[model samples]
Target chain A: MRQINGQPVTTTNSQTRERILEAAEAVFGDNGYHDAIVDAIGRRTSLSKGGLYFHFPSKERLFFAVLDRLADRLVSKAEEAAAGDGPALDRAEQALRAVLTALSRKRRLARLLMVQGYSMGNQFERKRAEIFDRFAAVIEGRLREAVLNGEMVEADPALTARIWLGAVNELVIHWLHAGGPSPAQRADEVAVVLMGGVRAPMPVPMPAELAR
Target chain B: MRQINGQPVTTTNSQTRERILEAAEAVFGDNGYHDAIVDAIGRRTSLSKGGLYFHFPSKERLFFAVLDRLADRLVSKAEEAAAGDGPALDRAEQALRAVLTALSRKRRLARLLMVQGYSMGNQFERKRAEIFDRFAAVIEGRLREAVLNGEMVEADPALTARIWLGAVNELVIHWLHAGGPSPAQRADEVAVVLMGGVRAPMPVPMPAELAR
Candidate 1:
């Protein structure tokens, strides 16, 4: 096994990466992307600049890695809430609630998730879309079930998922960046507006006693 | 009257500004904020760099001016569609259709409104928020009547308008930048999802007559 500085290179390299990401999240979350410095992360992780660069080459890559971890955490929360035998709509709500609750607990997490990348432009926008799409896929799967179970009117699940995620994105922006009500408080209302569109259409009544 | 180039200052000043805005819109819309050259706008307007600088001072301001003009056009379109004795919900739909139809007719206009300034970051995002808020207020006005007239289930008109606008914004973005289907094609479905949420609740039953 390869050893560096009397430690296994493989294990320490991963541990160092995990450490760097944790510290980077705090730094990035505290100061935002533009204000943050590599040295600050290096100091936070007890690594030299050379060591930091050895693991992740640039600040942009490091920042996005932090975002990926955050996104992965949120996606799992959404999927876990969405899983099981519950009615799909309720599960969808649970997924929404899970995300909102998690965000509400940590303002910094919310900022990192929604606000930090505003300055980074195209790459960040694409990343935001990718993360939102990940969340949408989880919800879209549940919504497809909701439709199949006759819980909703016939509607395109893919489009509905995108729209639903968009509304949530707006709601979070209002709460976090725009000085509006917290999303947890507004979660049900958002659901009503978005979900109402899909509520099952008036069921087609079977022809009543046509034989008569 | 102050005249440097043989034209009356006040009359030509306003006309010059108007001319610059028109030419700048074409340039910025075609090449985006970063790629579009100020000199291109100057050339298109038959004005020198000094003449162009005489009106708007910087490219950022010039770009925002174009966006503001476009947003104003959209805002007025929404208000006009909403300005009738017909049902408010239909008016909202009309407003949505009007905007989407206009956008479908011109990809560049849609790009200018929804896609450009995307790379410019904070200033652009703020401008976007401002423009969206303008559209939201117009729709909110109609939705207020929609709620009062029992056209929708009880909903916060302000929030509903924001979410509705957010959905439309996302649709346009997907259509323009993300290779998604045209928003014009999905306009009705967009309406169903967002409007469904605000739909008026099932009404209270009239009390049985005590006289009976």
Candidate 2:
């Protein structure tokens, strides 16, 4: 550890930043983006407001930072679920299930990540989009592999990933705003409907007229 | 037409309101909600700010009204496409196609309706949800009918509708924000993926491990 003025500098600095984020996450998660106070975060971290501002310049930046942390954890969970599985489609379904289940289990985090940021303005929306694209990339990678392996037919992996994430986003938001089946509970059904889209063409004949 | 003094009362009054909304839509569409000036709308409509206020209370109110009017037109278009159709699923596909195609053809309206309001704050988010519910209801209704008719099997119509709408929303936003294949061009691919979710299950074998 490099010492500056008889104190470990880099470790102490990063440690303080982490502590501030943990405290900020709770503050923002509890009060929402607009209501969450920077002072309150400082209080939770036992740091002065000036100290907090040194790490995060504004409430918006702090909120976005918290969201990035949350996205990181959630993406890791989804990747883990998708990494080891029977088939590419199955693993993809597990990845979707993992995300929904994680969010369903953490209502505050769900509200903060998905619903709360709307009040912060367009900047927050852009941040939301950036996070969504990250999730889409993970899902898209598996889907592209599935397509390549001939498990599915006639679907664009990139577009299919957006559709899947969009479906998950809508379900989760609906769950948060309006009382309904949790995303985890609906995950299987949603997966089937979505997966059926990209799954290989069915061998059975369609009703002649109904057939495309 | 009832006359107020010498002028037709409701006709002229309502006409002026419509004129203001038409101008407001263009202003909001071009400048977005935040950048758009009330005076600009007033200028386009040949009305005073006071005159515009007599119809709409604030820019937020005026924007919501514009969204409502746009929603009305778009919903009517979707409903028309869904009505008087062959299979419920086909009608549903047509409805989805109608929306994507309509939005694709009108990028300004799409930008205003879908993307611009993010800067306006939480109220705009609520309004977006309301409009989404209206679109979802139209889709859900047909899906429920299909479920009862045995054209589709083992699906929740309400949830399925959200999945479909969410996909469309994501695609449209992608097209608006980032350059991509227009939603209209991708409509067929999207529809098949979504509609396949609710379509009756085929009498085909899945890999034994994936049967679940």
Candidate 3:
């Protein structure tokens, strides 16, 4: 049995996989998606390219795996938070705040997931969408709860959820790109704008054909 | 003189450079930054790579030049709209509306400027900052005028401007990524949120921290 990072590789493939992922996250975050290489990821675990491949077939697969891990963590946290005893509005805010804190601490991983996610297609994109859908589901559930609780007016919960998600993602990207303040500040601002609108929907102009 | 895009290429070096920039915008919008090439840009005007090189040494430089042109146009439009005859609030809204419209119409350029801008450093970054600063100045001026004219409450004009800019940019990215309905709806929502406060600024946090 080969010894790697003071762990016996033969004992558990799952443990080895976890280590490889952690290493991948660090490399991808530090050097960016375009610059990170498989060799670099393997070196962190004192493993060869073959060892890394045994766990993740390609960098794209590894990237998606890392993203999946983060997304799952977010979903689990949101579900757990939302299910907790609290006001609907407060629950939503708490869930989002947790997400922002997690993202802030994992700046490199967050950046990679965002900037590269949009450009990636094929298998990588499938995983990205899955993660997005998972988060969206949580938001939708919270929105439904809000509507039921009368904390928010009845509207398209899914659409509203997507809009909130978009706003949060955009704020993070700008924050990352500009090297501005912490994500907490951005999260607070986003929360304000999102929750600021009147409980009533604004009068939107309808197209002539639609009106007819 | 050699034939160039069926034109005589008689304009001054600077003017010809400007013409090439205009053409590049049209071409880049049709294609995309990574997919766009110098030859396609040359086909739009009487400028070869050699001639273009005289002005911009590389494809990336030409792309930056295009971004510069668009930035200048937006800033100039904002300046004109701000200085023109209208209510201070109306003028500020008009200027922002103009910016949002321009960004939506030039989606490719907006994406290029955003994605590539992050990857650039040193001179390119400085150039990008210079252009962004020009627009920021326009926003600040109008904000100051709004407070002076009593159209808006007194606050940090600079911070207000950045917050608004950040919102618009975030919305633009969201609109693009979602492949959704008109951006105007979301843009209007943002404008309303900024113009008014969510929860009336909490009645005691003052308006400074709440502005963002």
Q: Which stretches of candidate 1 lie above 4 Å from their native place?
A: A1-11, A26-49, A201-212, B1-52, B115-118, B123-125, B201-212
Model 3: per-residue Cα lDDT over B1-212, one tens digit each: 64557976467777787788888887765554544678888878856777677878888777777877777777877787677767676677777777777777766766655444433222343555566567767877877777787666555565456555655655565565666754555556555555653223223443444443
- Candidate 3 CA-lDDT value: 0.65
Descending-lDDT candidate ranking: 2, 1, 3
Angstrom error of the Cα, residue B65, model 3: value is 1.7
lDDT of 1: 0.79
**lDDT score of residue B54 within candidate 3:** 81
| DockQ of all candidate complexes | 0.33, 0.30, 0.11
DockQ top scorer: 1
Model 3 stretches astray by more than 4 angstroms: A3-8, A116-137, A144-150, A153-167, A170-181, A185-190, A199-212, B4-12, B26-51, B79-91, B114-163, B185-212
TM-score of each: 0.81, 0.83, 0.72
For model 3, state the Cα shift of residue B102 in Å. 2.5
Q: What is the TM-score of chain A in candidate 1?
A: 0.84
Candidate 1, pairs of clashing residues: A193-B197, B152-B199, B152-B200, B153-B199, B153-B200, B153-B201
lDDT of 1 at B52: 88
